[model samples]
Target: MEISWLGHSCFQLRGKNVNLITDPFTPQQESAEPPATLSKINASIITISHNHPGHNYVQGVGGNPRVVRGPGEYEINEVLITGVASYHDDEHGKSHGRNTIYVIHMDDLVICHLGDLGHALKEEQLEAVADADVLLVPISGGKSVTATQAAEIISQVEPHVVIPMHYHPTPDEQRPAQLDKFFREMGVEAIEPQPKFTVTKNSLPATMQVVLLTPR
Candidate 1:
């Protein structure tokens, strides 16, 4: 399967028979800079982590895809998806409402997308995502976990590969400094960002690996 980042927490996962997009962000009207455009992006399935504008803009995606918005078990086009209930804040949704962490089974691999996850995992949450071969985590600390918390989440999930998201970059100015903290917390110096990431079951690293994907 191949994965491509589409800015913010959005990602396009391409498999053998199915294509999936996670958390498609709408254009930020308040900002002077244009947000990532989702025009012409087609997916067989779209998984939404929450109801926020940045994560749940279904109309922006084409193909009339089946949309999964909350915690549930769904099977679409040979892909198995389990959305585990989570939160958007540390206070059990009192501040930011509910979030869903999706564990998707496709192409003989387990991929977990933690959508705006705002806290460390509980025991049950950890059990649900412990089998993740690839983990998509939010590292920016606005409404989700911070860089330090993100590293902690990584240890809890213990996935073979990790891809960080939800942080600022370029025009935002704080991108480099924010990511630098995450790298330091992860005990890495620096990793060059890739345009896309391709992985197979047999090709997964024996140890946990951190991958940086440049938003498309």
Candidate 2:
């Protein structure tokens, strides 16, 4: 599988010769990053974890993607997408609307997008997270979990790889910090990957680690 970060919580993952994008927000809005145009492809699966301005702008993501409103399970196009229910805002799932987290499992990899997740997991939620090869998280403060909470989830899920998102304030965004605090809390050497990252089943590590993607 190959992955590209399209700023904020939007990540484009290519697997099974197709693409999957998560939580797309319009750059004109409160978004800090602009969309990455990979003209070669359209998003096959678009997962919306929440309805926030930063998490759900159909236009910014571009193309006609089969949007998945998650918190449950669906299998299509040789990919299994399981949506785990969560809270959209802070206040322990009390604010905004219900948040959805997606788990994309394919031939060689399992990817988890914790879209604007506001709180930690219960035992069942932790069980769902444990299956991921890569865990995509929100590191910025506010409604989403803090660096401390994210660090705890990482400990519980123990994924082979972690992709931190939802921090990083570009000149365009008004947010405070980026993924640095989350990295320090996790106590791992963060790798600033090329705009895109490729992985095969054979290359997965047995232990968990954090990977910070360089935005396009």
Candidate 3:
């Protein structure tokens, strides 16, 4: 399977028979990095973590894909997806609102996308994503987990590969500091970002690995 980041928490996960997109954003949302246009992007399935403009915007995607918006279990085109209810703020939905963490099974691999997850996982939530081979986490603190919290989540999941998202650092700003803090917490200095990440079940890493992907 191949994974590509599309600005913010959005990602395109391409498998042998299915293509899925997670948390597509509207272009109107302000960000340090401009998002790739979703106009021509096509997906067999589209998973929206929440109804927010930055995470919802289903009309932006093409192909008339099947849209999954909340907690549920779904199977389409040979791919299995489980959406576990989560929150967009630490206040258990009081501050922000509900979010869905999607655990997808495709191409013989388990991929977890934590959409704007605002707090550390509870035991049940951890169990839901414990089998993830690749974890997509939010490291920006606005409506999601902070850099420190993200590192903690990584330890809890212990996925073979981790990819950080929702962080768009601009020069002369604090976002860059947050990203640096995440790198420090993960015990890394820097990693060159790749355009996309490609992996297979047989090629899974024995130890935890962090990959940085540039938004397309």
Cα-based lDDT for every prediction: 0.92, 0.76, 0.91
By TM-score, who's the top model here? 1
Give the candidate number with the greatest lDDT: 1
Model 3 TM-score relative to the real fold:
0.94
Error of 2 at 185 (Å): 0.9
In model 1, the runs with Cα more than 4 Å from the true position are 29-36, 172-175
User: Which candidate order results from sorting by TM-score in descending order?
Assistant: 1, 3, 2
Candidate 1 lDDT over 83-175, as tens digits, reads: 999999999999999999999999999999999999999999999999999999999897999999999999988899999999867875344
Clashes of 2: 3
Compose the digit string of candidate 3's lDDT tens values, residues 1-216.
Answer: 999998888899988888899988888756544345677788899999999988887777888899998998999998999999999998999989999999999999999999999999999999999999999999989889999999999999999999999988575534477778889999987888899999999999999999988888
Winner by lDDT between candidate 3 and candidate 1: 1
Query: What range of 10 consecutive residues in model 2 has the weakest lDDT sum?
Result: 32-41
